[model samples]
Target: MAMSSTCAQLCLRCRGFLGSKTSTRLHYIQSHHWRIWTANSKSLSNGLFTNGSFTSTQTRQRLKQHMCYYNNLTVKYLTTEAKENKNADDTVRSTDGANLPQMPNTTALSIPENMNSLDLDAFNEPSALEEISDEEAVTIPFPTIPPSSTSLRDYVGKSETLTNLVQLGVDLWKLEQRPNVGSMLLRLDFSTDVAPRLLFLKNIGVEDSRLGYIISHNPFILTEELENLQTRVNYLVSKKFSTETVASMVSKAPYLLNFDVKRLDNRLGFYQHQLKLSASNTRNIIARLPRLLCGSLEPVKENLKVYEIELGFKLNEIQHMVIAVPKMLTAKKQKLTRIFDFLHNTMKVPHHLITKFPQVFNTNLLRLKERHLFLEYLGKAQYDPTLPNFISLDRLVSLPDETFCTEMALATLEDLYLFQKTL
Candidate 1:
């Protein structure tokens, strides 16, 4: 048999009348034989449409109508099947694939039998997407601005966690929030446990070389680490680095200088006193050092020291100081000697003043003399590689009006100097 005849026989035997009809339509659509199918029915020669015996136009019209009806019916049936499957899927709800309690309509208030016993009666119904009312909204608590570093513990305090974190230099902001890291931080054993996380955060500020340098090197950000930040700051100061170099590094940090004036003064006084006196006296002051270290002191103390030295009045003796209120340091005699020795030798005080003030000195000085001396000391500090390279006086000439303060600049430089020398 020919290919067409054999195909027709197989369709009739396997699929009855419907199979033959579908096969013919498939064959016509696939073969681009639309014109042949719609041709004359009388063209069906010898009862076989493939032969010249079939040629009637009426027969072609009937066959065309049958193919169109069959196609439409098949599409309708498939669409209905899909809809049924979707409806079945919508019935599943819980993790177990069990049916959920669903509303009959948008307006019906009848609660589902399953969820009726639960505490989610208010949320049982689907919530509207639009803002229903302020009363119905969920309130997301805003994160509290972390208390300034002054209120926090020192990285090396009783907190093992904080010490480890400070050593590693981790960024606190980048840390992934554990199940409830913030809450845990707030309520943790602050005297012991909290320091680690905070110190870790401080380290993170240090590690952000681009921005972290600003924070890490910043007196404000590193207030907590001031007592312990000897190596890094000393290295920078020893290189004869300028204040601008240090300032530029700190300008990029994310924190502000939030050290408390009164608190920091007390702490610095306690430390400075111990430094001037014998080592035996140091033990008495060491007990309270942690309290001051963990508080805001670095920035305020740094700025204040510059003002005190520049003014030529003992900071502890000044009548009305910004951060200090006179009579703060009890061992003023010893403290003044130590500061004088430090300024004269390591700082390279002028030859004229060296011979004049030789061993003992008084805070009272002629006007502008102390300021002049301070500027000169700052200059030497920047150029001297033997000490920590802090700030270059040259850079001060270029600072903006808003960011630069001659007094504060001097103070900062002085702070850097003292910090570099003695930590």
Candidate 2:
């Protein structure tokens, strides 16, 4: 009875101490104290200890173990609670009204049942990518001029000429299907001064489609003074170009009319005198390559230097080469050097033969190698120009595959086919 009273007093004291802690700690203390008391009672009832008194050291060891376990659990619980509280604080702070920006509500509005049934796929169907017409396409707006600007004013005395130019522009646009012809004419700042020159161009056989091409390409031709256009024409005629040729040149290259007469004369003189080409040859060259007259003479001069210094060609030989293949003068210096080296060193062809057949240099290097190697393999690679069996470089490279195989190589088609595969 006394021991029971003492146990009750100890339990009361434990409860009193635990009451000051959290509910979880109070519950743990009550459970642990009850377990210790029951164990002590069982030890007492079994007489496990010799003495009537409990061992204070054993009781203190058990208390220390329980305290250590409870302390670890309390520490774990406090850590979990601290983490949860921190998360809650962070969430609250992040959503604070002062820190957050106001966002618009973007909830979708409900669609009607009928609208839901519509085929939305029809809107995404592939459509033809038709070109936009000039009327539909956007263009830079024309510059606005004052109402009293000359472009807006009608020539009071030359109403007929104004009507003629407008009619001409409209008809020409219709024929060529050119857009913004009216706008372009306004931008050219057309006036009565350009009327007689247009008439003169028409009188000189530049009419209809030809005239349209000229005016469309060079609208300023209409603004050119009459004397300038006439002098250009007269200069061409003085060079013995027929009236037809002069008209054709002008229609093809209207800017030819804009070139200074002295500059044109200098270019022509270079072709005839420096290149040693006859007047007829010079005309033919100009007709064949109209751009030659348009470009500067520097390229021609540079090409001559390449021929003399690089290829070791005499002046007469260079003239012959240019006359035969005028484009060779325009060929890159590196390309010319490669071809010359291959011909002189690799093929062992004489320099005279190379100059005689300058077109050989223009032939593709791979094709040249294939043909020469195949012929060499057949022991028919004739290098001498005097030999009866000699193959001219032109005839060798220019011939069709079958003709070259049968006539030059004298091999069957199958043999040539197999040889080509090897190459």
Candidate 3:
């Protein structure tokens, strides 16, 4: 009897309920004085049901809803496909895969199987797609092609492409009103705002004799071609900068290029641009040099005085050569004679005599100045962080007289400013 009751309890626990069967079992026990209830028993057994049977009924109802949903979905898909097929047949369109549009045959591109979504023919002629107004096109963002495997050059050549190539060759090789290089530069400048990729090609590799060579060799030119012009120019300009002391003066500075004297020589690393100078510019430079000092045609004592002041702390071999200008400037203008006398006279002056007294005649004063000046000017010393620390010797030599003077003044100002910065 206890065993039967235990079985009934187990069944009720498994079913997650004890309401009806449990109550019947309790009534049978209280009124009829029976503790156990068998499954086959007449009274309480009829009210009981198994948990598994109830679970199966719930599962069947959920399955019915799912089946109904699947049928609806299948019917809808079939209806859409049938309508599309009917419309296609009415138009008499060929359903063969070969009839579908193909990707433009870019020279040689091996597309991967995973990129099946990409329409190769669409990339075949970029210009055709470009002609479609932006409003008509649907732009979908796609993943970038890996640099190692993808080649964009295949897509670039077209009928008009040859015309552009010929024009570029002519621009580089043929002469213009100014000169071939000048014409190329001017033509490139005009297209600067409209087509910057072309400008970047011209700007860099200025030293390369042929445009075609430059285009093929420079990775930057390739990248710039893919991007817009403004972005290309900004990047190219930044790349052209140098590590020298005068780097800042020439980089991103206004009117600075105009001041460069070596603009025409194309020798110094800096002389790619033309320094436009007038005849008047030449005259101004000759006038600015301290005139042949005195009636004797030699640099006067006054000229030496100014040299002493210019040297600031001390004089070196160059500065001492400058000091002997008086004796070197004799009546004749032979280059060797002038250089010789200048060196000879300064070496004759004794160092001890110059330092004993603060006066210019003190021989040691001049020699001591030479020693100090050599160390100070050995490298173009930077005085300010904002300006160039060094001036270019080659550039200074090539510059027109007036421009050279301007450069000197600028250098002097830079040196003074840097000195002040330290304080």
lDDT of 3 by residue, 362-401 (tens): 1223333332233245443222224665333223224443
Per-structure clash totals for the candidates = 45, 0, 19
Residue-by-residue lDDT tens digits, candidate 1, 1-423:
133453344445334423443445444432343344436433445434664434556545655564554344333323433355456657554246876443223222222333212122333355466455576554745434444343333223444444443454534443323343323333445445444424544453433334433333331333344433434434334434343443333234233223344443455455555235333333233222223333444543453464356535443333222112222333244445455555555555543433333222333222122333444545633433245744332233334423433433445544544544542
Pick by lDDT: 1 or 3, better one:
1
Better of 1 and 3 by TM-score: 3
lDDT of 2 by residue, 199-276 (tens): 677777665567655665666576677888888778888999887777667767767777778978888888888788
Clashing pairs in 2: none
Best by lDDT: 2
Score candidate 3 by TM-score against the native: 0.20
Please name the candidate that would achieve the greatest TM-score relative to the true structure.
2
- Model 3 shows how many backbone clashes? 19
Superior candidate under lDDT, 1 versus 2: 2
